[model samples]
Target: MTLDYRWLHDTVRDRFDSDDAMEAFLPRPLTPDELKQQGDDRYLSAMSQRVFRAGMKHSVVDAKWPAFEEAFWGFDPEKLVLLSPEQIDGYMNNDRIIRHRTKLQTIPRNAQFILDIRQEQGTSFGEFIANWPSADIIGLWNLLSKRGARLGGRSAAGFLRLVGKDTFLLTSDVVARLMAAGVIDQTPASQRDRQRVQDAFNALQRVSARPLCQLSAMISLSINPRGGLKFQTQRY
Candidate 1:
């Protein structure tokens, strides 16, 4: 089915009180050059942050991230991969961080994931992300979900967004907009639905020439000023 970009644009534009307001609501994603320049350690840090961020307040997680960086040796994959299980379990005694043992355990595992990618691709994690085709971004999400610890579903997408990847968010409002546009019948909780959502974004991009980040925010705003978040029980 063909999407109505005109309707989407007009609806979003109508929702906002002014041009400045509309622009402020849009997301500013990192350029390819900027995305590639970020260090692998930062990616690891972001991945960990995104994991802990689930079912918790982002502000609390963000507030303690500096301690996490210091605690995890600046999130260097090599250093983290070397952490012994006892050392991982020992984080429970530390008050500087969240102190959740289950979540903390993912650090080493995800570090190994990062290392494997580095060794396999022979590039910084940022370069790997930057080089990924945004048109097939769902594939990237799937890969992250499969390889990284606790990086399933929105967590995978959240990590990508945290790192300024140019991909659309499947927020509640965005999904509603997509459904209304005949893009999908329901929340994109399956790979099949996700592919459809991706295809729709690609179609929208072809006409708008806007990055996925901005388009996603616009699509969400088209339906509502702000939408409630709903995490899926199953990974897409």
Candidate 2:
């Protein structure tokens, strides 16, 4: 007998509506186990990014961000300013972090801009963070495109979503999960994998209207391989 694709799709969609349903459908969260299997360094980095992003989203002022700020010298535009041209040349030889000469140079300027925006808005740093705009797919695409950000549109969207912006509907690992679940046929997987994931997610919206993050996480966990979902671990 031919499998009813529509029924299969609907079943998958229904299961993704609730974590309880998802857990009932699958024994455990799909991706975490796989990630744990990867090894300490990889797992730790991935967990760190996830935790950092979550803190950023919830406006947890005293979390990983404090450490990040302290390490980067307050991320103050003036205080942790970008490296000078001479300093940039020296950074090329330093082995501290990935040395993107241009980005390193832009860091101070970006910090300054962030500071200016904070001051102009007349908000405390914590408030500014709490009220920061959700980096939805379209907004992030526009923002990154204007700045010539390294990643493509979908990749940027995924990164922003991973960082706690709930605006985007889907992410790369989520898309992989969907494909695994047989909810959607695989097409040319590209940097825009997040968009594909979002498309499937939006299709489900027609059935059960709900928050995007809740839906995305449910769908992702459902379809994720035995290995955990792959999230972008590094910021720089």
Candidate 3:
């Protein structure tokens, strides 16, 4: 029910010889105020980027971001939400941005999702995301999936992580450790198992007072040989 911070720290430190690697294992998430202050455009850009990252190389996707910014009108939720169906369809042949029509379509659909949350909640989209409780991050994930197009499951989780939210990723390595720790029997394919995993991280957070992402990384590095994380650095 409890994870030893010392053990997690030492476990990772023993593997990565660079003294700074463990210290930088996970990016420093923004404070609530910082989260609240971000523009919705940034959120849209980050969300769209995650969608592109799903099927392409990070370097390739990143290199095209400048064109994406231009093509999507700087990811302005209000503006994007108003794009015509024909206008969205028109991007299918555009070389300036990723030509995948479905991914291009998420731009306008997710833009509307952001605006809806702002109007319904009577706060900025950033504020709405910032106000979400970290302990109930799964709840936030569910909300995003239910409301935003192409944001279900892992896409929702990736978006949250990109926006500097405090949450854990159920990566393969983390799942392996979760199984080893008796948290679950296998990959959390069912909602019930996912909830159980969230509860486990919630408990560990209560005990260790650590960020969930860091805990996930620690769990990832906790398995197998000491040098397992040589190529596993997570970028912010």
Candidate 4:
């Protein structure tokens, strides 16, 4: 009972008035070289931003990113990994940034995680991100959760999406469409359920020759019909 890829593409195209308009909305995954060129600072910043954005308004976090950049010393992986507990605790009192101590604590820990990747891979964290196969992106999400602090589930997927990695997001709308297509009985949390969802996306990607990001977006359009993502209150 998988949704037809052609049908999903057609439905999404029909939503827009013209072909060009629809084309503009389609997401394209970055190439390995392009992704690798982003450097560690950018990857660190993107990861930190996505972490802070969890369970909070994106615009509010985005508006304060400049202060974040300054406070975190431009998110340099080498610099952030050395951040002391006293410095991290000071952020709790800093009014310019989000004051959630738990979330604030993740920055240096995750920064060290990024540095570990560089030490092991002999390349920037961006290269590590770029090398992950899109077809098995769920595995990467699992790795992130296991290796990096506060990088499980939505945070991992959201970070990948933010960095233009070719991965599908399991947003509520996408999960609803998966249920309707008989891909899953409920929101995928367990490894078995998440693997099923990944397999479904892989099948669709094979049929359409599109990245998972595009397939995910098209599926959302097919189900929701109306455009724009409405944030759900619950963490998925």
Candidate 5:
């Protein structure tokens, strides 16, 4: 049966504009004051990536996240580089996140690549992320394809776009929400792109507020099944 996506889109549109609206539509994370407070930490970006990965593992692919986490060193970029070939082979045979060998092998190299960018750019991780360089559709697609190391190419791209990667204009839940809200016609295939579109629509609606992390949680709650949104739920 075909799924209707209008309600999901509208819900995202209405809530993302304001904290209260978002809270009313979803759940609470950081209070208003906390969102207002800022530092040089890339905690939000890191958390967003984690959420994207976990969501891909659990919701999209029905994999065991806990095992994935345990096997992958908490998704730490630095630690991932240390994994041996045997470990990658083991992960392939295990019943965890997508066990694609190429994806697994790419983890460490990808981590190293990011680290190289971080050093070469002379920017903090947060700053580097905040200034992601993607202008058009192709650029965004390439950026996502590259960043999503261990995830499948299309899935990685979708996840990046969903989590507000600056290049693309798609996101899974955001597109679903947009479809639900009647703001758009077709459901975007790329989750990341869908999210970008939702953010753009939210901006047009004049519902801007601080604390995107909190809003992220709200978004997750609205779309993800119960117990599926928690970051640490899948204990390693």
Candidate 6:
């Protein structure tokens, strides 16, 4: 049976030492203007970091980010978009960075993708992320998967969370809550399942008057009490 968001939030609150502790644990949602103010290079860098972190040890990727910044020219989207064929080839043997060729190639391609968006929408990539409706976040995930390299499944959602875009990540804890609430019968794999998840979150957001980020955290805390599965919390 579906529970009211108040019940969910209280359940999470109960697990904490105090109300202040709960508040400190949850992330603050970014406003549209705040999101827009983030530089393009920061967005590109975050995207690339997420790409590299997938299926790899996050600490390892993070430890090498400085080399990545130096090698990739501080993740400047314009500069990356202008990368020469020779420069792309050189990274394969570069000892300074992770030499995974496929992931390496996505950097410039994603840079071009960012530039394309600016050209088409006349807004920065960060603004584009901020302007997307939270109610249709699954649709935003689909768009990112199609338009941005290496941003499918949870990666797109993770990227949104990383940038403080006020969206939810469909992590296992959230999925479990969704299933328990009768939102879905199984893991959300099909388009219909994804839509159901989105609708469920939209309903919760309306009922709770909470941003998707806090709602996601609430669901997670409700599941594991001590906190959900451990993962890297470092922001790009």
Ranking by TM-score: 4, 6, 1, 3, 2, 5
Q: How far off is residue 101 in model 3, in Å?
A: 0.8
What is every candidate's alpha-carbon RMSD to the true fold? 3.7, 10.8, 2.5, 2.7, 8.6, 2.4
What shift in Å separates residue 181 of candidate 4 from its native position after superposition?
A: 0.9
Question: Candidate 3, residues 1-236: lDDT per residue as tens digits?
Answer: 43566676687678776768666654466788999999999999998998888867877998999999998888999899888879977888688888987888888888988998889999999999988988888889888888888888687888888888887887778888788777789898788888888988888788778888777777777774435445433331
The lDDT-based order of candidates, best leading, equals: 4, 1, 6, 3, 5, 2
- Residue lDDT tens for model 5, 122-144: 85444544554332334444554
Q: Which residue pairs of candidate 4 clash?
A: none
Cα deviation at 142, candidate 6, in Å, is: 0.6
Q: Which 10-residue window in model 5 sums to the lowest lDDT?
A: 36-45
After aligning candidate 3 to the native by TM-score, how far in Å is the CA of 96 from where it should be?
Answer: 1.6
Per-residue alpha-carbon lDDT of model 6 for 1-236, expressed as tens digits?
Answer: 45578788778888777889777777777899999999889889989998998999888998999999998889999999878778778888889899898888899889999999999989999988889888888888898899999999788887777777888777777788889888898989899998887887788888978887888878876786652524334321
Instruction: List candidate 5 segments past 4 Å from native.
Output: 1-22, 26-63, 93-100, 131-142, 150-236
lDDT of 3 at 69: 95
lDDT of each: 0.84, 0.43, 0.80, 0.84, 0.46, 0.83
Where does candidate 2 clash, by residue pair?
31-228, 31-229, 32-228, 34-227, 34-228, 35-228, 77-111, 77-112, 82-108
Please give, for residues 1-236, the per-residue lDDT of candidate 4 as tens digits.
Answer: 57788877888888888888766776777888999999889888988899889888888998999999998889888888888889878888899988888888888898899989999999889889999898899999999899988988788898888888888888888999899989899999999999999999888978878888878877877777653534222221
lDDT string, candidate 1, 1-236, tens digits:
64677887887788667878767667777988999899888899999999999999888998999998888889989888898989977888889999988899899899899889989999887889999999999999999999999999788889998888887778887888788878898898998999998998899899989888888877766776543333221111
Worst 10 residues of 3 by lDDT: 227-236
Cα shift from native, residue 187, model 1 (Å): 1.4
User: Model 1: runs farther than 4 Å from truth?
Assistant: 226-236
Can you give the lDDT of residue 149 in candidate 1? Answer: 95
The predicted structure with the larger TM-score, 1 or 6, is 6
Q: TM-score for all predictions?
A: 0.92, 0.47, 0.90, 0.93, 0.46, 0.92
Off by over 4 Å in 6: 227-236
- Candidate 5 local Cα displacement, residue 182, angstroms: 9.6
